[model samples]
Target: MRKILTPLLTILHRNTCFSVRLAAMALIATLPGATLAQGLFSPAITVNGDAITGYELEQRALLLRVLNAPGNTPELARKALIEDKLKLQAAKAAGIELTPEELKAGMDEFAGRANMSTDALLQALAQENISRQTLRDFVKVNLLWRNYVTARFGARARPTDAEVDRAMGRGGASGGIQVLLSEVIIPITPQTAAQVEALADRIAQVKGYDAFSAAATQYSASNSRADGGRLGWMPLTRLPAPLQSVILGLKKGEVTAPLALPNAVALFQMRGIRETGGSDPSYAKIDYASYLIPGGRSPEALATAQRIIDSTDTCDDLYGIAKDQPPQVLERNERAPRDIPRDVALELSKLDTDETSTALTRNNGQTLVLLMLCGRTAQSIAEASRDQIGNALIEQRLQSFSASQIEQLRADAQILER
Candidate 1:
């Protein structure tokens, strides 16, 4: 089966500068073992008869390496190029093409991320053997894909004002307490119900958030599994009345006993609880750390992650494990929830200080990601700017819709990887 590179696409879309850097590097990186001219046009992979050349793969790998994108760069490059081919094919089929002016504008927009003009970016790329045409082509495909997705999915993707308000925790007229929750939902069929129940019982006894998160990654069927079952902040009243009481009873850092549903077993972890005077009760800041594990989501890799989780209690404890690893392997930062990747943010939302999740993967599923929440700072609704809240809500919805669209595309396409 062809492995989808959806994660790589997510990374690239979230960090446009990283994609641009890859574009420049893909154009510049020299080929080995063959003459540059020959290698430049040689097929590395083909999607629906469209070839992604070896040169393109090399350039993407070089660029990903340069930007410190995690996992196996060459493999990631191959997958990324394959997906790009698919996107390009889809866009062409949909009659979506970027005009010359539109393409130029896209390039300018990309260059602006680094505070450079198109010519300046091109000059920089040329210094490293990349061509201006390469950058233009990169921008052109992305522009076309963006236009296509928006045109096709925009109505469905659009968030109602009430939906945005609910996301911002302002849907209700009356004030209420808000809680930060991390949730895992394990799906079950009639055949798996008993087995799932047993597993849920075991998860209930897991020692920490890290263990819970690992379980979620391995066994959960929810979209939140990508971030280890994190649900971020929402009003207490927003929850189902029965679950609200159960959640309110959980102490900070406590995971609930599995609550059986019609088709799934659900659990929640209480990261925090706070009261607010106004409608919004969202967090203002979050501090966390991510430690990269080499293998993706394989059982062996998961076992290794379990070991890491068992060996540590706090983000600081990870320092001992990271003693000889590259500095980039461990990252600690304080960011707004909106500034953090959606997956990571959700995981962090399910954690108390020092709790970790092993739910996310990187580099086309060649690496495991361990994310630990270090702290969260809450702001009163009065202090939180409406614009910031609204913008954040819109971005989150857009990200969810974009991911869904890509997944649907991959599902419907007849992709052949070489």
Candidate 2:
């Protein structure tokens, strides 16, 4: 694999820039000799009698590395190939096939994620010894599996109006509060701990929107820092329980004292708070868990998260998984939506109870957060209409069904690794 990379770059020299060529050259230099000695096209693994070649693994790993995907690249590549095999097999069994237009669109959409055209993405991959077929196969499997899942389970997953009411707490008490707030989340590290802490203290003391927004622009690591930490009107019930009272007690333009979080310090400024009518309901509490896996977004960490998902059924199951590890490695908390970190909360919002996401990182991407939604305690008014909630419920249910179906396929399949 490593030997061929130089020639691959030679071919790409005319098309890719000098910097990309240098990076690819440097990347090839780091490949272990032992791995390069293997027959590149020989089977490394087999799923349900379908072979996964060493060439496939290498190409996929290179693609992931180019995309800056977290976790052990090789391991993640292996896992992905195994899953792709299963997905394709299942899709075939279900008689699911993609139209050429759908295939082209899938490829286009995938390239767009990297802010590139399909041809450009292919050229980039070619620089790293990855062929166009690798990308095509990956996109095809995903599209087929998605179509299969939607077709198989779409109808049965829709929620009734009563279920939506229950989910929204529609008939419960009204007059809940809503707030407009700004936020600042400063990162803390061992080297810069003292400096960041001092800065956070000073930022907490800042008064008026301009002062706070300036501080956020200068020091906040949050994505909202670009917009001066400004957040839209959110219901009080959406805030973490620990922060709700503190925020409510603040007058306009006053900021809260610095609050400690996992490897970060958070400060919120109260822009406005007001009582809301019955139409806008909110949650009382959201139960969730975060299990930390070291090595940031490396492939090994991602593979471990997948194994954990296979073994665990709920948040409680994480306790047992982390029993002998450090206490901080696993955390289960019930808080308001606004209290969770924006990234984690965003992932949580899309998930149903017991469902997990590995999209969040902490400690400067030095750790991966295996986040799971334990449950939600609904109360107050409402947001989505019955039809919208029904659609959401259907999507959520489909995710669960898709996961289960894949698990079943994996269990039944004969998977062998060399």
Q: Pick the candidate with the highest lDDT.
A: 2
Q: Write the per-residue lDDT of candidate 1 for residues 257-364, one digit (tens) a residue.
A: 988654467778888998877664446566688899886667787888889989998778889999999999998898766677645654454555666766676675
Where does candidate 1 stray beyond 4 Å?
1-36, 170-394
What is each predicted model's overall lDDT from 0 to 1? 0.67, 0.73
Q: Tell me the deviation in Å of residue 232 in model 1.
A: 20
TM-score of each: 0.44, 0.43
Where is the poorest 10-residue window by lDDT in model 1? 1-10
Each candidate's clash count: 1, 13
Whole-model lDDT, model 2:
0.73
Candidate 2 matches the true fold with a TM-score of 0.43
